[model samples]
Target chain A: MGRKLLLEHINVPGINTLEVYRKTGGYRAVEKAIKTMSTDEVVEEVKKSGLRGRGGAGFPTGMKWSFLAKPEGVARYLVCNADESEPGTFKDRYLMTNIPHALIEGMIVSSYALGANTSYIYVRGEMMPQIRILEKAIAEAKAAGFLGKNILGSGYDLELYVQPGGGAYICGEETALLESLEGKRGNPRIKPPFPAIAGLYGCPTVVNNVESIAAVVPIINDGGEEYAKIGIGRSTGTKLISASGNINKPGVYEIELGVSVEDFIYSEEYCGGIANGKRLKAVVAGGSSVPILPANLILNLVNGDKRLMSYESLSEGGFTTGTMLGSGGFVVLDEDQCIVRNTWNFSRFYHHESCGQCSPCREGTGWMEKVLHRLENGHGKMSDMDLLVDVSKKIEGNTICPLGDAAAWPVASAIRHFRDEFEWHVRNPTLAVKENFGLAHYADPLPELVS
Target chain B: MLKVEETQSVEFSTELVNKFAEIVSRYPEGKEKSALLPILHEVQAVNGWLSSVAMDKVAAYLNIAPIEVYEVASFYSMYFLRPQGKFVLEVCRTGPCCLVGAEKIIDYIGEKLGVKEGEVTADGLFSYRGVECLAACGFAPVLQIGPEYTFYENLTTNSVDQLISDLKDKASKS
Candidate 1:
């Protein structure tokens, strides 16, 4: 098995409880950080770990902490973006559900490093169960003297609270999360004064994903250099891959960052290959927002090098033939699935979740959804293909948030990779609705690798 | 969406008022506005949905304008604008789930309930809707019932049938 930092004790009975978690060396990082290291020392350790934000952006976590504006007398905040709403991404929910205290411990250590006494975990409201689990965990930690005022008698103080989002996907965005936390509508804010500079009640704030925060525990416990030694260069440390869709074992898997895409999908150690012995057709290696790649492209690079599940490797060829390791939401599709219907389904999700903050995303997502809906239902015109791409182009990078680009990428990428499937839907409209345009060239053998 | 016929004024119980106070305490002193989402959830738990009267009352309690509450309530998918059945069955309908038969599960729930999406059953026992990704695609074909938001995952049609019956039995008993 790959090294597990966050989920090492995940299967331990009663790991969700403070006693079991503590017994298994859960809060050692908190104790080590608070009792021994300076705040800067903790930050320096994270910086040295080379941990990137696991929420999808892949921005360096240590650098994000370094960006926090530390103004005198101004309360800094660390808001854990527990709103794991991206389609196909459920690793945060899994991590938070199974090992609640790991996140709480990470929260305390991270809050200290950012010099924030007050922090809030902005969980999506649908995860009321997780919110309750975290709340119970936080209460237990506070009772154990790991949280609240003067923790561990180290003269450091911190207060952590769990805030529920109002079930909007856009709240997963950092600034939008801040807005939702304030109990306002979930709308993306214009950048340049990113959340690090001014956030959460206008205080200097840092918003990190749930997995990113939880990863801090091991970084502090093992020392950053030791933690960084596990994964491939730059994509240091293990990542939690939420493998879903047509995979045989569809669940969360903690993988060392450099694992080949083929091993992750087909090996018994990971996804255990496609379900029902079906051939793999396509894979959304990341969440729905990232480009969707056919089987041939996903398993190998354009140059026929084996694709690895790291930030640099997955995104090797850019949007053309490459996808992202976004949120590690690896969704696999077998031979039977229809790309057209799935594209339409994703477009509908984006349109429904646009937040209506920007017209390009707001209007553009609706157009994509409507157009894709027609295509999926076998009512598509030939020009509808170009129209879809045209609309996607208009929306990409034209909105205040990435939601526009997110909505556009899947539609554009599906057409880019599977235009014939879409054309088949158009030509054989009746047949398309009755049956899927099966695997086709997507499962073809890759060209011989160049030495 | 709050029709004149459905606007019923709500009274905050002392117990609930105390709960609101606790939620408000989690934020900074002046930023009691941060408590709005949690407070609305608490209020919605009491009543099945947020009426204009209830929302305005929430606005009054938070010291924010009533429009703030309305805007937030309408913006979010969770808060019901109309009265729903005792159990709101939210099934995941996004791409990953659909690949693994989430759409079938949603259709099953709808057909079994005899109520289309957003429509409450006559018995006032259940309502079902297709929600966007619940972030549980790994356990696709999943559904959850709210108040506690208890999840039911990897649902087959038979399992869904068992759930509806179980929920029906539960409602009759309680």
Candidate 2:
């Protein structure tokens, strides 16, 4: 059903190779933009397309591009953030591994628009296989004249390299990524001189997420207005939702924006409902960093309006009642899952990845993890619930990078929505260790568990 | 306990040297320090782990201080501070994976290997550790063996034993 834009030819045979990709209208976007469109035209087209950044922030892409400082005799850069380390988000890995050329093609067009002669795709180091896949595709593109000097004889030149991050999720933050790109510790830099003004080696830079960059090909092919018309309102173009956890079909699905949340989870064409006929309890609509919503809030607004999967709709009530479409990492949880245990697990992840840069983030994340660990293991106090919220609130918006807030949102929201479940853990410590708190009020009119 | 002092001159093969040169060239002139991450990858691939010698050699090659190489290498989780076994089983233990029995998967690897997590077997054939999300949660209970870059998905306790045996077989052959 829905119109597929980014992943139209995803399953085509040999699409991974440059030859097959080129046959299926792969590099045409490059040719059209380079030979026909001016650099300003390309930038203006993206602005008109209403394309927002897919890297979780949802900032306008064209505005981010236009911010690049074009200082005289200075170089600018386009670094693709391929560090797909956000838990439950594998779309970037899926894209780069299966259809590498689309990213390569998009990189060429985007590099031209930013007037950057060199670009780097900073992929997480764990995806070594993906790095190899991209390296092969880049070499293939270079030999075909899509890369290197005077590409397609349009007088624009670009060189793209696939750099590996040494396994730190903080590096996914653009400034931290640039620091790691320069072979330093992955501590994030402060603002004012945003990456657009002073980045990598003190040169102006534009670091876009992998999907954001790859989506450029489709926008150029369809024209800005045409591309903008596909998705509902400001959530223009298609988005790759990587669905996992308690879903019958857990994989990446490229859905046109504005698909209803209920349809995406219940329809056979998408997630095909919860696995094993289990009742849905909670779902992290975005990645692990975003707030987790119980089934009631995820499916409907407070005013009983049916919720759709768009930037505006998902975040309707802000952090209190709604969550983000962050990174499109749709993780679903069924009735049998324990919110306390799950929150504890994510708290530990944030603690492990704190980067030790800021006092609040470095200290607060660790304290949250330790306290949550106590609560999950049945040693929690009734006061520990409030302590968790207090610690989470302190870390949010206090660090140089969003990782601190990313750590805080899940814990804070879980306690906000599921205070009863957390309270039960403290009350029934022995039973909590032996069994999960179960669905409770997570799913309204809860269906009986199948098994 | 972690090795840092060098004992001998560290050298790269001609092919590796050429690859390093190509990587360095990607950065601007005098910005060769940016090649530190990839060069460390190359060194680890060649020498098994980054000994003080290899790191100092990377530092000398980049014209940066050796401390620059050490601090950067230690901050990242991928670089082995010690020489791990031939097969490093990095199990994804984040929320999604844990929801699908990742805790049991990791526990099984540790029990079967007869070593604690992060400790190599005496034979140096395998090492196991619980790592954070590898972003492949759709196939939950996943593990990656590096620097071979192979992923084992949907793992059970029995499959883990079979995996360890298969890796042992391959390790003996190579």
Candidate 3:
């Protein structure tokens, strides 16, 4: 069994209640941090633990905390990004639904660490159930004296509120979330003034992912060094992978960071392999935004090293033969699935979700979607593939936020890794719409490495 | 924009007004504009959708301009600007769900309801549309109904039929 820090007691009945969660050692971090350690000490402990943001970017958590600008008499805020809208990514929703108090406890400890008296968890509006759950849990915690003025007799004042997003995926971005929290349209802000420097009502703020904040409880419980000792290299501690799409066990699994891709898929511990005895065709290791990898490339690196689930290991070859461990939304495609259809599906999602703050992302995503739609519907020309590549390149980095790059990567990567299937569509036209090209060479074994 | 065709005015109930007041209290004093989204949700939940009058009243309640509310209400996929069926079936249509048959489920719902996507039924009881990921891909081919956003997952055509009938039964009882 792997070490389950955040979800150790997830399956216990009544775990969502404060009483059962308390029995399972919840809120111990709040007591320890508020009553014993100073704010800087809590931050230092997280820094030593080497925790990275689990919300796709993989940026170091402690470093993000340190970036908060603290001017005297200026209030600091910590906002939890609970907007888990990326397709194939559902870990935050699962964690929030099953273990609501875990997040509340982390909020208390993290708010103390940042010396902020106010915090909010910006959840997506579609998760009305989860927002209600967190609200109930927060009220229970407040009644227990875990929140509000002078918590646990420690003279630390904190108020945590659950903010609902208006169903915009762009709000998952830190600045866009802050904008939404301020009752504005979800538009990405230009950087030189990142959210850490000035955010939410123009205060010095720190926006952390829900998982990153929840991981703080365990880090503060056992010392940071003990927490850091679990996983390999910089990818310390366990990560929750939301396995979906053609997998037998399509659910959230927390694994120690170094598990190999093959074992994670085939082993009964994780995904339990592709569903219904089907052969794996391809995998999107991260969420939809990351590059999709062919079966051979996903199973083994270009150098023939077995790919592991750690941030460094999964991204070893850097886009050519490797993909990100983004948000840990591991989606698997069986041989029966069509890459062209899936690509078109993802393009449509991006096009619909483009916030339209930047012209390139707004226009480019629509163009890609239309072109891919035609390609899938048997109306594409041979030059359509290159046109897609060209348009995607134009949108890659020309926007106010990474949503542009996100809109670009899947289209580019699909063409890079699966051009032949696209060409087959252009040539076969009507036949392509009637049937898929099937697995083709995607599942073939990688050529042996020459010494 | 506000559907000018539907010019029906709405009056906020005292209880809902109090609820709006509570939502506004969650933000800092000068930042009552922050209460806009939550207030709009509450308004939409009470009435089936936001009319020009309802949004104007929400703006007055929050002391912000009606355009502010209009821009936000329009920007979000939620917050129906026009009236909808009492039960809106939002099925997931993103990549992962499609991999596991979301599209087929959407088509089945449309066929069974005798209404296309975004169109209300003749009885005005149900409307269905393909929404983006609901963050429940593991339980792919999922659909949810609004007002509470209750989820129904791992759907087949039979499950969808059962759900529509159950919802019809529910509406009849209510």
Interface RMSD to the true structure, each candidate: 0.6, 0.7, 0.5
Q: Candidate 3 iRMS, in Å? A: 0.5
Q: Give the range of the ten consecutive residues with the poorest summed lDDT in model 1 chain B.
A: B1-10
**What C-alpha lDDT, on a 0 to 100 scale, does residue B10 get in candidate 3?**
88
- Candidate 2 lDDT, tens digit per residue, B30-116? 889899999898888877678888888888889989999999999999998677877889999999998889999888888888899
Which residue segments of model 1 deviate by more than 4 Å? Answer: A447-451, B1-5
Give candidate 1's chain B TM-score. 0.95
Error of 2 at A203 (Å): 0.9
Query: Where does the lowest 10-residue lDDT sum fall in candidate 3 chain A?
Result: A442-451
Write model 3 residue lDDT over A327-372, tens digit each, in one string: 9999999998889999999999999999998999999999999999
Q: Candidate 1 on A16-94: residue-level lDDT in tens?
A: 9999998999899999999899999999999999999999999999999999999999999999999999988999999
Error in Å for residue A345 of model 3: 0.6
